[model samples]
Each structure stands twice: as C-alpha cells, then as structure tokens.
Target: MASEPESDAFHEAVPLAELEAEGRALVAVEGVPVALFHHEGEIRAVNNRCPHMGFPLTEGSVDEGVLTCHWHHARFELSCGDTFDPWADDVDTYPTEVREGVVHVNPTPRRSDPPAVHWRERLDDGLEQNLRLVLAKSAVALQDVGVDPAETVETGVLFGTRYREGGWSSGLTILVALANRLDDLDDEDRKRALYQGLTEVTSDCADQPPKFDQEEFAARDVPFERLESWFRENVEVRDADGAERTLRTAVAAGATPEQLTGMLVAAATDHRYLDTGHTFDYVNKATEALDLIGWDHEAAADVLASLVRGLASADRAEERSSWRQPVDLAAMCDETFDRLDDLVAEGEGKEWKRPDGFTDRLHAADPEEVFDALEGAIEDGATVEQLARAVAYAAGRRVALFATNNEFSDWNTVHHTFTFANAVHRAAQRTETTELYRGVFDAAVNVYLDRFLNTPPAPEPSPDPDADPDEELEGLLTCFETQGRVNRAGAHAAHYLDGGGDPERLKAELGSALVREDTGFHTFQAYEAACRQFDLREDAAERRDLLVAAARYLSAHYPTRREREGTFSIAARLLDGERVHGADAGSDAEVATGDD
Candidate 1:
C-alpha cells in the first residue's frame, strides 16, 4: 500500500478510491506506460512492462497485495514493486501520493546513467588482485595436501581472474590448473569452494558478450606428465585397502582419468597391491577418473565393464562389496541399453559402431541375441537374479517392438519365450485364453523347465582353496555361454519326452540319470515326478535314504536354511536315536522325544 517516491515536478493526481476500483489499470505518462495499483488502502504506480522479458504488468492480476505478470508469472509487491524473487529484477517504482481526495504523481524526467567506466576498472582490478592472492594461497594449500604447486599458481591466478574479467585467453589455462591441482585438496569443503568460485568466474565471462576468442580458452595445455609424476611421488599402492582409500580420496579431490591414467597403469605394471592377483584397483581408478571428467555414455560403459571384468575373479564376499556387484553392473548396462534404445528410436539412421574386439562382440548383435547370451552366461555361472533382469530387458524390448510394429503375431522363438512367460503369469488368476496364447504359454513353460532340468554343470572350482571365492564365482558366472543353443536343446527335450514324442526312451534315460548316486536332489525330484506323473507309491527305503541324504546335506552346508524347523531333523537324527512318528503327537511327547 506504499506510495511511489516524491519528486519536484507536479502532475495530475487521480483519486485513491478511483485507482482502487481500477486495479492493475494502465496509463501513458511522459510517453511511458505506467501501471497503477491500490492495496492496503494506499495507491502505488510502477512501469507497466516487467523488468524481465518485458511483459505487461498492467494486464496482470493483483493478488494478496502483489502484482503478478500474467505472461511469465513474475510477481512484485504492489507497495514498492520490489521483485520478491531475486531471479527477476525489481520493477521501476514511480512517485505517487494522496492529497486530500486525489493522488499526486511525480512527473520529473528520469536521467539515464551509463555504467561508470572508472568503477568497472576498479572492480576489475580488485577482482584480479583478489584472485591472484587466492591462487597463491591455494597453491600452498595444494602442496600441503600432497599435490604439486610448481606451475599451478600462475596459471590459476591468470586464467581464473582473466576469465572473470571477460578474458577468454586465460580461461583454458584455469581449467588446466584446476585439473592439475585436483588431487591436492584433501578437505571436501575447500575443494568444492575452489571449484565453485572458479566455475562462477568462468560462467560470468561466458554470460557476457563475446569480447574474447573462445578458442583460446579451449587450447590451454593440460600438464598430464606433471600430474602423473605427482601421483607417483605421493600415492602409495601397498594393498587393496590402501588402493581403494587412495582412489576414493583422489576422486573426492576431483582427479580426472586422463590425468591419473599413467600413474594407475604404472601401478598395475609394477604389480603393486595386486590383491586377488587382478587389476581391479586400477580398473576402479580408471572408472573414477572417467566419472570425475564426465565422460560420454559409451566411454563410461566401457570403463564400467572393464572394472567388472577385473573384479570378476574376487570372492563372493568381495564381489558383493566390490565395485562390480551385479546391481552396479546391471545399472550401468541398463543405462547403456537405454542410450542405445534412444538412438535407435530416434530413427536418425545413425549407426553406433560397436566396441572393438571380443569384449564387445555382444554389443553389435540384436537385442534378443544379446539377451540370450546374457541368460546363457547366467545359467553357466552368473547370478540367476541378475540374469532375470536381462530377461526383463528383452521382454521390455519385445513389447516396444510390438508397439512400434503392431504385429504381435509375428514374434520369433526368443520373443515368444519371454512374452509367453510374462503373459501366463499375468493370466494365472484368470480363466480365458485364445488358442494361440495358451499354446505359446504351454510351449514356453515346457521349454524352460526342460532346459532348466538339463542345465550343464557349473564351472569347476579353482584348484587353489585359498583363492578368493568371489573371484572364482565371478569367473564362473561371467564366462560367456551360448544360451540360445541351450534353449534349443531344452525345447527338443521337451518335444521328444514331455510332449509324447518318445516317452519310453525319455523314461529310460531319465531313470538311469536318477539312479546315479552323485545326482543328489535331481534324483529326489525325478522320483517325485514319477510319483506325480505315473501314480507310483512312495518307496519307503528310497524315501528313507533320500531323507537321510537331505538331512546330512542340510546339517553340513545349509547354514542359510538352518533356521527352518525342518532342518533341525538332520541334527536331531545325528544326536538322538528316537525316530519321529506320525504328525499329531502331543506337544509334551514331542518335546520329550525332541530332548532325547
């Protein structure tokens, strides 16, 4: 409700009541559009055009004693027309006052003042001096944090201040300085502050008119050799724990991969701290470098996969805690897949060249083929849960294809496999199905079950017992296998045996496999199958033997499953001679027998 400023010139005044009736009213005064507002029982006037984007504030609304621009919704307090949000510049307030029943407005002409050149020069000089002082202090700080400060001071001072003053020739020099001294700041707050200040200076220059050559800022030489030497002199690689700690510290300090690569490579070549006899630490360093430098999607993905491979030979406990857990790798792979999918979906006819050599063979293949390979790898040695995610990816891709083509009926075998499983799961609670859907579901499940039962043996354990179990597991699981061929074999088995093609031969072979003593649970499952399929009575002797084996196996190895009451039987049988009888024994009797 505050009035505008007072001035010497006299002008016709409108009544406060009248102005209130005409809220957000506009009028031309001295060839300028002035907007009038009445709030809190007071009159005010301001320039009609918004300071930002020049929208007409007069056409806006007066809400809660504030004038809001309708175009972009920038709001200003009507009392003083001050921009409540600093992001928008404040509105120009005009002089207005009430005299008796009328409002008076100042009509004095406002003079334009050019920016003071002397002031600008003073600001520039002070800013440059301040930057130079900061750079000198920062150089000393860098040295204290184990970083080389030999050439960084001059470069940082010159480039950082010059860039702030619209001098492009020195911006690139600042970037180089930043990259070189990145590993020097041990304190996160100090490091972040330095980067923030540098970024602010650069951004200010970038926002200004192009007064300097942009190319100069892009051409500054990065001192990779100096950085490498510094790392070699400072970073110690005595063990994996030390390596991880050092690498994490470097990442926190903002070290770039390009700058840290030579040092990492040297460490690996020297076999320093080669825990698990692999280069996982070096791989992790490379990955950290890439992340710090904001590498492109493909480059990041390549580095991630390389890290995974390096850690692939670690123990299960190590693998879970290592940088290459399935969750981590799956996330990276998913991101890569999404990027690839987006590129394809754009239909720009741009083909991304796949990575070179055997490591990238799967990248160039079709999505389904890639998924099949992933599944095969999981079946052989990879975690089932991880492989299930890949299957999900394939399923998602199939759906996307169907959406694009509208040809759901023309799916390939692989597509049908995923689709049918998903559809059957969704339809399990329902009763209706078309012949095609039913057939596909039945065929897919039969094929999967047959393949599952006939899965090949897992990889052989390493001869060295002291070898890290996680690494062994990773090696076994990540080794590429042909899932498509396995699936085909499964389908063939299902067709000839479960599908009534050669029941007699199937029974003979299965029976022989079932009787093999080393077959373990497979034999018990086969017997259960026979009982269910052929209506055979349970063989007491066979059941007894199976129970005994199961109990022994559970007692010796199933630590994860030991909490189950069923598992207690194994221990009970070994400790107590009394056999458990029928199911309805009294609790007291059961407890007495259990104690015995």
Candidate 2:
C-alpha cells in the first residue's frame, strides 16, 4: 500500500450540521489540537490544554453541558471555557461561528494574557519594561476603541500579561504612557483618570515590591501627591491591594502621623482586609510612621492602643491551630507593650488625661464581669487565656498595695495569696476547683511535710506503712510540747495549709503549738480546719473568742491586720463553707468541697 499522504494527518472539520447529538470530534487547526462538542443545539470549540495543569481537553468527556478534563477531571463550561473551580485559572475562549452548515473557527488565535503586573512592577526595569509595553498596546487599543477610563483600566488589567518571562518593562512603559495621557486632559478629569488607573493597577498588584523610591518616581509628572491624597481619602477605606498601594504611597510621600493613623483606622474598620494578613504590616508601619512624625503623646498612645485592640480581636477570631505552630502571643504582646510603655514613660509624666471618669470607667469594667454577663455569647468556646492574661496584667499594678506595710514580709504574704487567689479563680471558672484544689492541696502538703519537716535521713530504706509517728514525734512532742511549743508547730502547719495543705492532724499540733507561742494566724487556720473536719460548730463561737484573744496577744508583734485578713478569710471559708460571711459568696460552693 502507498504511504498515507501527510495531509491526512490534518483533522478535517466536521460539518456543523453533521455533529452527532452526543459526539465530540478532536480536530487539528493550525497544528494545534482543538476539541469540538455538539450539545444543547450549539457547536463549541475549546483548546485542548486544560486550564488546570494544561491537561488535554481533547481526551476529556462532555456530559450534561459540562466538559471534564480527563487528566484531572476538572469541569468547565463548554461554551465559555469558564472553569467551575474558583482556584483554577480560566481556559482560553475561542469565538466559534457556523457558516454554510460548517463550524468555522476564527483561526486568528484568541489568546488570554496573564494578569496585569501591579503598579509595584514599575520598580523593576526589566519587569517594568514588559509591563509598559503591554499597557502601551492596551492603552492605544482602548483609546482607539473609545473606552472609558475605568473600563480601560479594567480591560487592560484582565487581558494584560502580568510578568513576562523576561520582564514586565513593556507593561510599565504602557502605564507611564497612560500616566502621561493624564496631563493632556483637563485638571479634574486628568486627576480622576490617574486615580482610577492607579487604583486599578494597585488593586491587581497584591504582592507589592518591598520598597519604592517616591521622590524619583513623582518627578516624572505622575502627580504622586494627588494620587496619594485621593487614595487616603477614598481607597484607604478598604484593604484591597489598591488600598495597600495608597497607604504605601502615602508612606513614601512622608505622610503625617495623623494621616497615617486615619488611614489605618479606616482600614481596620472596613473589615474587608481584616482577614487578610496585610493589615498587620500596615498597622506596624503606621505605628512607626506615627513615631517619625512626632505625633502628640495622646494621639500616639491612642493609636497604639487601637492597634493592640485590633490585634487582640483578630487573634481571637483567627484559627490559631491552622496557623504556624507555637504562635507566640507573649512575644507579640511584649513587643507591643514595650512600645507603649516606652511612649508612656517618656511622656514628661503627662498622664494620659482623658475626659473625667474615663479611666475609672475602664478600670471598673472587668473582662470577667463582661464574660459573666455575656456567657451565652461564647457558645462552647474554651476560656480565652489571653484575656485572662490581660486581666492579670491589669491587676498586677495593684499588687503593690498589699506590700506597703512591711515590704518583704508583706510582699511574701501578698505574693503567696495572689498566686492562691488566681489558682482558685481559675479552678472555679473551670468548675473543677473542688477536685483540683484538693489534689493540689494534698500533694503540696505531702511534699512539704516529707521534704521540709519529715524528710528521712539520706539513703535510708523506705519506711513501712506500719511505722510509728511516735518515734518521729517523741522528742518534738515531749513535755516541752507545751501549749506554746505545740502552738509554734501549729502556726507552721497553718502556714503550710494556707499555701495549700490537707493534713488532718496538723490542726491539733498547731493548736498545741500556738498555746505556747501564741502565733495568732497559725491558731486561726488550725482551729478553722479543725472545726470543719470535726464539726466543731458547737465551739465555733468559743473559738472565735479565742482567736480574738490571740489576735490581741500578737498585736504588738508581727504585721497584724494585713496578715490576719488572709488567714482569717481562708479560715472562715474552711469553717463555714457556704455559710461563711464576707468570703467570696460565689466561691462558697467550691470552698465547701475543701479542694483548694
């Protein structure tokens, strides 16, 4: 047989009318394979390259008005080549027309260029060169066609090739030419067109260059100030790439702190860019810009506060788990706090004077209270540990008040109480206080007694359960175990208990010790625990009288009221449980369980 003719390799076009109802034809046009489909009474042709990963559309199947790429099973609208997957770039669309019962492709080759190179591309000569050429051709075409400025910008953006393999200089040159065109029009229209074009270009330039030289670029009659002002006034209200460009432009132009602050506030409030990571950088830059401008102390403080609040809000809403592991909230907070603290410290001691009662209002509004009031708002969300940390930070300043009397002595007491209070608060909120507190208390008591008081000699074998405490207590509890000596041990035991103790016999030992030394707080805590464990309500009034007497005896010695209050508070809670007077009523149930 004669060799087949090379011409036979070319695919013959199917007559438009001859297309089977459910058939597709793969044809070669201009040496490129094209897929043809006849469905829903129309002839559709698409380039064989799949929009996603360039899979061949020819090997794909058409069913129910959609084409599925065989390689990746990506579906597209046969008529428009619009990929159904939003993440997939759209496919090339070719105009198909039927003539004389034959489907004809325009053969001129319809090509879709890449997205436009955003204005930031102007910073790179090679890239800018390609971008300029693309823009130049687009502008000339758009002008010849009499397109509106907005439409012109949009059309060029959609059809322009963003970054050519070599560079984007062509697109930048086109943009510069477009910018020059602005000078020929009347002032108002020219400014408007420039603003519109800048907006469009910047909006498309999501990944901006790290830096730009504003003065040099502005010398080219770009009306950089006018464009920036327009952006600040209008575009900055949204966090689109366009808005980012405007802000960056303003920064480049040396915008004032107030101006930058205003832009940031607008961007933050818009909620459009809130989810985008761009806002963080903007806030940080704006903060630095404010410092450079020598903003009024109050204004700077306010701006810093706003940034912190915005960051906090974002942190809460963000899916931190999906974010990079070990998110460092403390590091971020520390940095922010340092900045604000420095500003405050250097402000000539000029306190941030707000309207009367403003500080008071903020101080009075505890987040815990807000959380309680809006309990339903949380749904089942875990406790906001950051919020708790913020509260602790605010409360830290007040801790000094408890240390005024006897610095070291008071500090130790207050510090210990502070830790206990925080633990109790956390436990109560979690509704695990009873068990957690008891466990912690028991473990602490055991550790302290074993390690501090009852520690065995080194290398001795472990003692049997049947070992007698009489041997350990022999000398310590001899006749010298008078009321005073016994009272001393009782006081020590009370110290351990208040720190988180659970020894049952510690109270009797403490009482006897206190009878000798008369350590008032020790007697108080010991008697309190004893009353609770042994149901000493019958002697409750008598014990209270005795505690008063002991308080009087120690009045001339150790720091009295301050130390007594914590001990007494803990004692009251232990003794009366829910019936305790003046102890945190809300904590009564937890205290009743004797956990903490």
Candidate 3:
C-alpha cells in the first residue's frame, strides 16, 4: 500500500537508529508527543495519547499493524489510526520519512475530513452513542474552527425531534431555550450551554426509535382551514398518524409559518391547560427553534411532528383536582374561549392601554373575574404579546412571592407556571393568533391555582435599596454555598438591578450560578424564562422583578451534591490539555522516555 500524502513541512523527530533499536520511540513534534513505530517493514507515527482517555499509547502492544491500548483494550490500525472500537475514537496519524538516517514526521495528522467535517461526524457519533466527552470535544473543536455554535444546536434539534418517538422531550425544549440565550453568553458558558443542551438531546434519543414520517399530500390543493380542522379532529381522537398527515398536508399546501403555528396553538389549547401548559410551551419552542435556524419546510415538519404527538395525548389539567376543586378554572376558560374570536375582533386596532389594577385582578382569587379582566384587556386593544407579557408577570409573581414554608417539591409548581407563561409570550411574538390567548389565560389560571403558595407572600425586595450593588451580588453568590436562603437571594438580585449595576454582569452571574449546580430540567427552564421576560420588558421595574424571581428560584434549589459535575469537570480539564488523574496533574498527557 502507498503511504498517504502529508504536509511537506516535517519536523526532525528522532534518529531512525534509536527508533529501530527499541522498536518504537516517543518524540515531541512541536508540543505534541508522537510515537514512531517500526512494524511490518513500515515506519508509522501516531499521536502518543489515546483519544479516549488521554493515556500514553507508546506502552501499548502492536501486532500485525494493530496498536491496542492496554487500558481499555481499544485497538487501532497503525497506518491510518482507525479504531476497531467506535467508543475509543480514531487516533491521529502523521506521515513519516527517513531523511539522512533520521525519522522526520509531519506534525499535522493526515485526515480524510477537515476539522469541521470530522468534528461534525464525531458529533453525530457522540449523539448516537450518548458520549458526552466526544460531544464536548466536538463542541470545542467546531468552535475553534470558527463554525457557528448555532449549527450544533440545529443538528441537535433535528436529531432529537427525529429520533424521539414519544415526541418532543424536555431535552428539545432545553436545546431551544439555550439556543435563544447563546448570543448573550461568553465563550466558556457558551460551550457549557451547548454541552448541556446537546447532552440532554443525546440522553433523550438513547434507545428511542425514530419516528415514521408522513409525506405531504399527493394533491397539494387542500385548503389550510380544512387541513387544520382535520389535524385538530385527529388530535382530539388521539390518532397521531392522521394528525401527522394532516399537518404535513397543510405544510404541503404552502401554509404560512403563522398558519402552521396557529394550527398547533389551536390544537394545543383544545384541552384546558394541556400538560399543565407544557404542550403549548413545547409548540412555541419548536417554532422558536425553527426561527433560530431558517425554517426548511421538511425540517420544520420533523420538528413539528414531535409536538403533534404531545398535542394528541398530553394530559389535560382539567383532569387534575386543583383546577376543578372549589373553583373551576376549566369552566371559566371554556366560557372565555367561546367568546375569544369576538373579543379579539372587538379589540383589533384599539391601541392597547394597560388598565389600572389589571395585574391585581389576575392575581385575585376568582377565576371568573380573572377571565373577565383578561377579556377586558383584549377588548381594550391589548395585543397578543401585551396580554402574554402581563400573564407572564403574574406567573413570575408566583415565584417571587413563593412562601419558603412550602415543601421543596412545591417550588416546581410556580416554576412550571412561570416558564410556561414566558413560552406562551414568546409564541405570541411569532404569531398573533386567538389560540395563544388561551395559553395566556391558562397561565393566569395556573398562577391563580398556585395562589396558596404565596399565602404569606415573601415581601418584594424594595426597588433601589440603599445598599452597595457589588456587596449584594457577592453576598448572593455566597448564599449558594449554604442551605436555603431563597428570600434573601431574591433581594440581592433586586438590589443589583435597582442599584443600576451592570445588567449584563448580573445576568452573567446568575447564568454562572445556574450551570454550576447539579440541576434538573426545571432549573434550566426557570433561568431561561427569567432572562427572556427580563429582555421583553422595557420597564426597569419589571426587568428587575423578573431577575429577582429567577434569583430566588435558583437559590431555592442551589447546592446539589453534584455527582455529574465531577465528570464534566474532568472532561473540561482534559479538553484544556491538563492532566487530571494523579499527582502529575499539572502536566499534559505524555509518555515517559529517555531524553534524546
């Protein structure tokens, strides 16, 4: 076999005599250690470090052109550095030539794919195999080559939506959520966010089978209204296949993005607070993911398909005791929904003015009054986004006013309502549909249902507190080191905003606080929602309040035992080319050899 071509610039490695005497010799080319081997009448140079765990490969045994790592028993071909085990990954290979009795090796590895292409393939492999380390490496590698991180988000969104048979998982939601925040994050956190989202995507697709896609209608003349009607009807009957085909049919009919979103919005709200408002949230996020990456109709269909399954079978909150007992929020919503079209029409072009005491009525105990109040807002010309924002603020109050006496599990109830409301508000921005109005109401009612959580509302932090912003921020982070101080945490975030401190710094700090913890799905949701709501508001008070709510929520759940954090830390250190295994942790991965 002929040797593959390599870069002409070769570094003098070691004398061929020395390499031949020991059968192999490890030499540094620039800063990297390359192992030169004489085997089967050929001299081969490969990266000395095992790609899997960074173990030195020079000590491993080679036979019949195969180099096997003694640690993991992973075998690779010496000539091309292709691994026999997929989990081990391929090692790097360098072209070598004998020059004046010395072995000269090209430091650059001869690869079939460029860095971007190889890392992309590795990313797919990582996703397929649920390998976080490989995913991390790929993230760093791709970014190093100036490839936009959003591309990875796109890759994950497609993979997750296509592979998860049960429909859109929370992993997809996290991916979309983090994608929205990527631009605001710094480099390291950007990578952290990417790793977190992609890792969740990998976990979600693990062992899950791909969905069978439904093609567009053979005839493309079906009207949008008819297809939408067919879609909702099938969804109501829990016929996923029929609903999917109808959805695809609508897409094929050249339905606008708004029309497609309207279809999901209507179906998702058909039941009272479906899946506790998560159904609409996922629909909105799926749409947002499409927004982040330019919508390809086929890709859009795959993303939406995940949501169609959820809409078809999501749990209706009407079935839950809390929504029905004492006060039937479901009935109120039904009455309000019946008149939604007229209300939306009655308010059209009205130039919305926020009614005095509007939010107060929303937070009040009576569901009927709340519906009436929201109806009045629509009637008074409040836009879809306007209504959604007010509703989201109410949800934020649920967390901001959360009573510490409640069980830790109860925190999720407020968290869920707030995140859902924020997601609905985001959807409203994409399309102005009467259906999303139901989501706004659903969120308000959820906040109402959670009223008991704020029975004795934690006092709202005084705006413009007479305190140093720097001290407050430092103190807030310190609380994360200790046990529950949720109320105090909220105050600090408020003070930071009130004191006119750097809003970017506060966001960055809160973001760091979020990722450092061993967290769950809800935490990511809460952080993203708070940041989102903060950005949407122009009022200084509202923005501060949102971050206050976020700080409290994060503090309530901070300081986890961090079992996974250890593994992530190790992977990060390894990526930085640091030794993490033992006393030689300060040094890079290398094999011991006598000085040449």
* Model 1 C-alpha lDDT per residue in residues 1-596, reported as the tens digit of each score: 33424555546556667787875456655545567778667677787666544555767888788888877688898766677754344666777766787776664323122223322232243234433222223322443345433233233334333343222222332233233333423433233323323333444455444322111112124344543344434333223333333333443344454434434444332321123222422343233334444444323323322222233223322233322332243333334334533333443433332122311223222333444443334224433222222332223222122211222222232233333232222222121212112222122222332222112321211123243433432332222122222222222323332223333333333332222122222222222222222222143322222222222211221122212123223223211222233343332223322322
Sort every candidate by TM-score, greatest first. 3, 2, 1
Stretches off by above 4 angstroms in model 2 are: 1-22, 97-103, 108-255, 258-282, 286-596
Score each candidate by Cα lDDT: 0.35, 0.35, 0.83
Candidate 2 lDDT over 1-596, as tens digits, reads 12322433333466875665446765656544466788877777786656444445666888888888776578898777777863333555555666567666543334443223322222122123323222322333334344445444433332222322211222322232234234335433332333333333433343543222112123334354464455444433332334434444555555555455544443342222132222333253334323333344322332332232233234221234322234432233233333532332344334232233321222332322322321211122213221222222222222212212232333223222222222222322333211222212211211111221112111211223343444323433442333233233223322333333333343343233332231333222222222322232233322322222222222222332333233223333322223333344433223323335
Higher-TM-score candidate among 1 and 3? 3
Each prediction's TM-score versus the true structure: 0.24, 0.24, 0.94
lDDT of 3 by residue, 1-596 (tens): 23466547788888888888889988877777788899987899998878877777887999999999888898999899999987788999988889999999887778757779888998999898998878877777778788898899999999998888898988989888877887668887777778788888889999989877877678788778889899999999999889998888777677888898889888987888788777888988889988877666468778888888889889988888887888777887888888989998998789887777877898888777888888989998988899998999989978888999988899999988998898888888878877888888888888888889999888988776577889999989987877888888998888877777888788888887766566788888998999888887798877887888888988988889865455556666666666555455343424333332
Q: RMSD for each model, in Å, please?
A: 29.8, 31.2, 2.5
TM-score of candidate 2 to 2 decimals? 0.24
Query: 2 or 3: which has the higher TM-score?
Result: 3
Over 4 Å off in model 1, which ranges? 1-6, 13-17, 99-102, 107-228, 232-596
